[model samples]
Target: MTAPSAAHKPVRKSRAVKTLGFRIAALLVISIVVVVGLATLAARLVFHKPVDPEAVAPVARQIHILITLAERDPQAAREAGADVRDEPARGRVDPKASRFLKDMLAYTGRATDATVIREPNSPVLVASVRLKEGNWLVLSALDFSPPNVWPGFVAWIVLIVAGSGAISVLAAIKVTRPLRIIEEAVESVGPNGELPHIREDVGGNEVRATARALNRLSVRLKAAIESRMRLVAAAGHDLRTPMTRMRLRAEFLPEEERGRWLSDLEELDQIADSAISLVREESVSGDAETVALAPLLESLVADIAAADLPVTLGRVEEVDVCVGPLALRRALTNLIVNAATHGGGASVTLDIIESQAVIRILDEGPGIPESLIDQIFEPFFRVDLARRKTIPGAGLGMLIAREIIERLAGTITIENRDPRGLRQTISFPIAGVADGLLSAQDVECT
Candidate 1:
């Protein structure tokens, strides 16, 4: 494939990545996670109170006195509020609290063996110490159940956050459901170029409002388009009757006068035909078929050259594009003829660019004024009166060319070439070989 000309540039596809529903879903999920995490941290900080050393001082002194008495006399230790036990206490204990008790004993210069435990279904701490008589003395200590309660809360917090994530995903999906519906509805638009009626009475307020607006807009647009097409068609048919009668009358006039009258009538007829064709092209389209583009361009160039126009075929690469054969051929013919007849000469080249089949028609005549460039596609928008006088056209060629190209999901862009002349580039998404693209040998230049 030949390289794209400087005038031809590919633009980024913004719509492909910036989907409304996907963005909304991501925003919702991220918000929910942040909120859940922050809430959990706040709850943890609010309920987890710090220990007061003054309140624990009395309890620490009493336990120390009992442990000392139990080491000297076991009987006196029981009377001093200690629960005498022959064997080690049953059930598991908090090793952290036991170590704390040992540290307290060592601080008072009396190293003693100790174990602290909080049994299941119990709300109190039990501290046991080994006496000198080789028996055990157990005493009730202040509650140490906060440690146990907070650990289970950690698990609950985890479970809550996990469940919340799943719930958030579902909620996000629900939140963006209307957008998905709208997308599908647009994609499923009928061949009549009208949006299908959607439910406006159901769903959330926003969804219902959107649906109602779309339905109303579709109705108004379809009506407007149909009215315009009908008006153009009627006008085109009505003019032919008068023009035909005028042609008969002109036949009886002098040779010189008759030629002038006939030429004017023919031009008027051409204008009417162009207008009707534009209207029909706007309202309707046929099934698209994959056809080779190189052969098509070559054929168009050959036919126009044979007709004594300054048209030439340049380097063309084999590529297939999906489009209606006859409509595309007509549009191409109009564009090539415009370039050749107005731009002095036409050189057509077909190339493949980033999976798109690109056709560029280069001409060498004086290019359009920069300020008037945008209006070139307007119906009957001829350039200057001088160009109009020389060119035999209804000035609907470029307008019709753009309409037919866009209808087939292709693009047409025009820019003035450096120094002089205009270049028109047409591109359509490449349709890889499906049904065969007709080889040049099989297509006769018509």
Candidate 2:
């Protein structure tokens, strides 16, 4: 198979990259992760101190009262479950608990450092502080269990994450909305020669810049295409005057020479007329209307049959499509004439398949070569080398037909039929509610 044009090749490769929506979502997810990570880091910095004053306050107050009692009366302090010992307790001191106990002693105006330990197999916290009499007073209280902050911390974290995610999604939507509009506008451009412009003031700087660029490009492209069509039309019209003068001058020649020159002039005239017609077909700007496929095909076949052409209509279905009636008829006529002149005879069929209207034109002549099938759609491309002594043509029939079909958001393809001939299939999307439906009275041929 032949490679696609450079324009289409880029599009195929572009599919490998991430789409705008996915990219935006990824960016938002990463942003949320980073933001949440930073928030967690800040929380750790502010709350990670080993000694918390509020957590150790109640335990410290009780220890201070017991110490006061021991300093006043040692026997009464012992009866009150406070023990004055000469040596430190045989237990491992928790550094965090010890730091908290030191802060507690300082807050209670005691000028001594205390050793805090967790008794084995007990929830009691013990602390040893030196008394004024040079004895270590062992103070004990139920362990100060700080309130569990994990559940509340987790709840706050969840809330923050969810809120951030929602905001990120909104931000992504805000960023991508204009891009989506631009994409729709670009895709809406068709062979109909209409280029829609997008709003440049609706998005961010980059999006607005892109919209402006696209608008300028659309305007330039439309102007260029129109200029080309005008040049073709003018060129075709200018040739007619010369051809007429040549025909007039040929009348003065010898009879034999006159016939030969006129025949050649007539062929030239036909080519010029075909070129003009092709240009006009391409420039067709009719609004799309609901047309019945069955009646249109029947009318075309009738016209061909009136010309004594071997054209048959078969399997006509009542399918409706939104298209320019005049352009569609002209395009179909070109295909039918091509089939009859080159393929010898033509058979037209219409059917509704998978919500699409399929129009097939089959002919009983030698089919085109597989290698040159795509080339035939190019303007003025001819398969004369393969056909040998085929009828003369300006080679714009298939090109005009394809342009018309594509303008109607349809596709036309040619394939070789088994045994002999070519099968040209044209498929159009079925008219939806937006295109509107046609009543019986509105089903006339153009």
Candidate 3:
């Protein structure tokens, strides 16, 4: 192939950047290092002028004695020790001593200069004084050990560490707050059918971009579902007119042939009606309200029993949930009917398990083959073509039930029971209103 154009050239993707948590941790580490570094630098600058403890005590003592002697008698004090010199002593001034000792000597009416020296091998402290007689005197002391830092250095280190830790914690919370909000918003989208918009004014560029993309996806998904419902409605309505016309024409056929013709037409009409009903149920939005599930299920079982169907309600707990009552009842009715049709009879029981309201529908007829169990919930799916002749359904019941249950934030599962028959289990989150209820009692529907 020829060389690709610049526009068509494959671009190499850069590696994904670190997550927000990792970046925050890195920032914390860097901030700690910078803080510690600055604290160390400040300590160095404050304590650059060092003092020899071994020399400071003796030097201060000797300076005091020299000032006292000069005030009494200058010539006698100078002649009392050979270590004392008249001319200025060879030494550097001590910054600390200049602040305190020099003032004391000046107050005594004696002019003096004090110095502390720290060299590689020799450490010395010296003080030079001028007497009232215009003569000079000097006092000297020797030190052995090396220079040492100020005592407050350790305290400064502790303060820096504590300050860094506090700053890091605050920074982490500031950086992750927006992410937590986005996470909750994304999770609620499935149950509520709408994604809450994120505040793009906060957080980093990548986070804002992700929020915008999720919002777009949510809008598109809502539109697509609405479009599909519209199509199903239109198709169901279009098929009804032709089916009605065919049923009308079937009436003129010979009596023997008319029955079969009318039966087929009626089945077609029922299928179209069922499709429309499913679409309507899926599209309808109803306000959620607190519902007592046990009473609702008991009434449903009573109605089914009155119809002469083999159904019974077993032990049921007084559990409440927030759901659209009409939708939940319809979904439960469909599950009951399916169990009765396929498995001959259904026995339903309810209980509270691990903070969830659990409902089980057990049956006593031949169980479905394991291979076809998963396919049964698909729209228009039937386990066997032969059974379709006897069973009058468009195979949308289970699919519709599942949709309704999931929309209510519940789960439904079906499995073959031991020996023979199928079991359908449904679980829903219990509403807060159900707390502190009376003990559950066995419910009988006769």
Q: Candidate 1 at 300: error in angstroms?
A: 2.2
Off by over 4 Å in 2: 1-19, 38-157, 197-211, 248-264, 287-291, 306-308, 320-325, 364-366, 369-371, 386-389, 407-410, 416-421, 429-446
- Native-referenced Cα lDDT, model 2: 0.75
Worst lDDT run of 10 residues, candidate 2, spans 436-445
Winner by TM-score between candidate 3 and candidate 2: 2
Clashing pairs in 3: none
lDDT: which candidate is best? 1
Tens-place lDDT digits, model 2, residues 2-96: 21221221111232123665677667776776777678768777886655667767767777877788888989998877888887676988777
Quote the positional error of residue 368 for candidate 1 in Å: 4.0
lDDT of every predicted structure (CA atoms): 0.76, 0.75, 0.69
Give the per-residue lDDT of model 3 (tens digit) for 402-443: 877876667899999899999999988788633322111101
Candidate 3 lDDT: 0.69
Please list the Cα RMSD from the true structure of every candidate, rounded to 1 decimal place.
10.0, 9.8, 14.9
lDDT of 1 by residue, 1-446 (tens): 12122112222333533365456556666676677767767987898886554556567777777767877787787776678788668778888888877766666556778889878888777888777777877887775334555676668657765776677667766776666656645654543466666777788887888888888988997898799889999999899999999999999999989988998898899899999999888776655677899888888889999999999898899998877888999999999999999899999999988878899999998899999999989988877776555567888988889888877667899999999999999988787531232211111111
- Per-prediction backbone clash count: 0, 0, 0
Candidate rank order under lDDT = 1, 2, 3
Clashing pairs in 1: none
> What range of 10 consecutive residues in model 3 has the weakest lDDT sum?
437-446
